[model samples]
Target: MKQVLSGAITMLAGHPVAPSTVYRLLAKAGWRKIVPRPSHPKRSGWSRRLKSSPRR
Candidate 1:
Protein backbone atom coordinates (compact mmCIF):
# COMPACT_ATOMS: atom_id res chain seq x y z
CA MET A 1 0.00 0.00 0.00
CA LYS A 2 2.82 2.36 0.87
CA GLN A 3 4.61 1.65 -2.39
CA VAL A 4 1.46 2.26 -4.42
CA LEU A 5 0.65 5.44 -2.46
CA SER A 6 4.22 6.70 -2.86
CA GLY A 7 4.10 6.18 -6.61
CA ALA A 8 0.75 7.97 -6.89
CA ILE A 9 1.94 10.89 -4.78
CA THR A 10 5.13 11.17 -6.80
CA MET A 11 3.17 11.29 -10.04
CA LEU A 12 0.68 13.85 -8.72
CA ALA A 13 3.02 16.03 -6.65
CA GLY A 14 6.35 15.49 -8.43
CA HIS A 15 7.89 14.21 -5.21
CA PRO A 16 8.17 11.05 -3.11
CA VAL A 17 5.80 10.75 -0.13
CA ALA A 18 6.47 8.85 3.08
CA PRO A 19 4.46 5.91 4.40
CA SER A 20 3.26 7.89 7.43
CA THR A 21 1.81 10.52 5.09
CA VAL A 22 -0.03 7.84 3.21
CA TYR A 23 -1.45 6.41 6.45
CA ARG A 24 -2.48 9.89 7.56
CA LEU A 25 -4.26 10.58 4.29
CA LEU A 26 -5.99 7.23 4.40
CA ALA A 27 -7.11 7.85 7.97
CA LYS A 28 -8.46 11.24 6.99
CA ALA A 29 -10.40 9.53 4.23
CA GLY A 30 -11.88 7.12 6.80
CA TRP A 31 -9.84 4.16 5.59
CA ARG A 32 -8.47 1.64 8.07
CA LYS A 33 -5.76 -0.99 7.95
CA ILE A 34 -6.80 -4.50 7.07
CA VAL A 35 -4.88 -7.66 7.79
CA PRO A 36 -5.47 -10.63 5.53
CA ARG A 37 -6.45 -13.95 7.05
CA PRO A 38 -3.75 -16.55 7.43
CA SER A 39 -3.65 -19.32 4.84
CA HIS A 40 -2.50 -22.89 5.27
CA PRO A 41 -0.15 -24.31 2.63
CA LYS A 42 -1.47 -27.89 3.09
CA ARG A 43 -5.03 -26.76 2.44
CA SER A 44 -4.11 -25.11 -0.86
CA GLY A 45 -4.24 -28.33 -2.87
CA TRP A 46 -7.12 -29.97 -1.03
CA SER A 47 -9.90 -28.11 -2.81
CA ARG A 48 -8.40 -28.71 -6.25
CA ARG A 49 -7.93 -32.38 -5.56
CA LEU A 50 -11.49 -32.77 -4.27
CA LYS A 51 -12.90 -31.10 -7.37
CA SER A 52 -10.85 -33.20 -9.79
CA SER A 53 -11.36 -36.53 -8.05
CA PRO A 54 -14.00 -39.04 -9.21
CA ARG A 55 -17.43 -38.60 -7.62
CA ARG A 56 -17.46 -42.03 -6.06
Candidate 2:
Protein backbone atom coordinates (compact mmCIF):
# COMPACT_ATOMS: atom_id res chain seq x y z
CA MET A 1 0.00 0.00 0.00
CA LYS A 2 2.72 2.42 0.99
CA GLN A 3 4.76 1.49 -2.04
CA VAL A 4 1.86 2.33 -4.31
CA LEU A 5 1.35 5.62 -2.48
CA SER A 6 5.04 6.52 -2.79
CA GLY A 7 5.04 5.69 -6.50
CA ALA A 8 1.92 7.75 -7.08
CA ILE A 9 3.39 10.62 -5.13
CA THR A 10 6.54 10.51 -7.21
CA MET A 11 4.54 10.57 -10.41
CA LEU A 12 1.75 12.95 -9.43
CA ALA A 13 3.27 14.78 -6.48
CA GLY A 14 -0.25 14.84 -5.07
CA HIS A 15 -1.63 14.96 -1.55
CA PRO A 16 -0.95 12.00 0.71
CA VAL A 17 -3.84 9.63 1.05
CA ALA A 18 -4.40 7.38 4.07
CA PRO A 19 -4.17 3.58 4.08
CA SER A 20 -7.84 3.33 5.00
CA THR A 21 -8.64 5.39 1.90
CA VAL A 22 -6.65 3.01 -0.29
CA TYR A 23 -8.39 0.01 1.30
CA ARG A 24 -11.75 1.65 0.67
CA LEU A 25 -10.80 2.25 -2.97
CA LEU A 26 -9.81 -1.38 -3.40
CA ALA A 27 -13.07 -2.55 -1.83
CA LYS A 28 -14.98 -0.22 -4.11
CA ALA A 29 -13.04 -1.70 -7.04
CA GLY A 30 -14.32 -5.17 -6.05
CA TRP A 31 -11.12 -6.62 -4.67
CA ARG A 32 -11.78 -9.59 -2.41
CA LYS A 33 -9.92 -12.08 -0.23
CA ILE A 34 -9.74 -15.58 -1.67
CA VAL A 35 -9.50 -18.64 0.57
CA PRO A 36 -8.60 -22.26 -0.17
CA ARG A 37 -11.03 -25.11 0.52
CA PRO A 38 -10.20 -28.04 2.77
CA SER A 39 -9.15 -31.26 1.05
CA HIS A 40 -11.59 -34.23 1.15
CA PRO A 41 -10.34 -37.12 3.28
CA LYS A 42 -11.61 -39.90 0.99
CA ARG A 43 -10.75 -38.14 -2.27
CA SER A 44 -8.67 -40.87 -3.92
CA GLY A 45 -10.62 -44.11 -3.69
CA TRP A 46 -14.36 -43.58 -4.24
CA SER A 47 -14.62 -45.96 -7.20
CA ARG A 48 -12.47 -48.61 -5.51
CA ARG A 49 -14.61 -48.50 -2.37
CA LEU A 50 -17.85 -48.73 -4.42
CA LYS A 51 -16.60 -51.79 -6.32
CA SER A 52 -15.24 -53.52 -3.18
CA SER A 53 -18.23 -52.91 -0.89
CA PRO A 54 -20.86 -55.65 -0.35
CA ARG A 55 -24.23 -55.23 -2.10
CA ARG A 56 -27.10 -53.76 -0.05
> Whose TM-score is greatest here?
1
Candidate 2 weakest ten by summed lDDT? 5-14
Q: Report the lDDT of model 2 for residue 55.
A: 100
Candidate 2 stretches greater than 4 Å from native: 9-13, 38-56
Task: Quote each prediction's TM-score.
Answer: 0.52, 0.44
lDDT of 2 by residue, 18-44 (tens): 667666767887887777756556677
Model 2 C-alpha RMSD to native: 8.5
Error of 2 at 45 (Å): 17
User: Model 1, stretches more than 4 Å misplaced?
Assistant: 35-56
* Clashes in predicted model 2: 0
Identify the candidate with maximal lDDT. 1
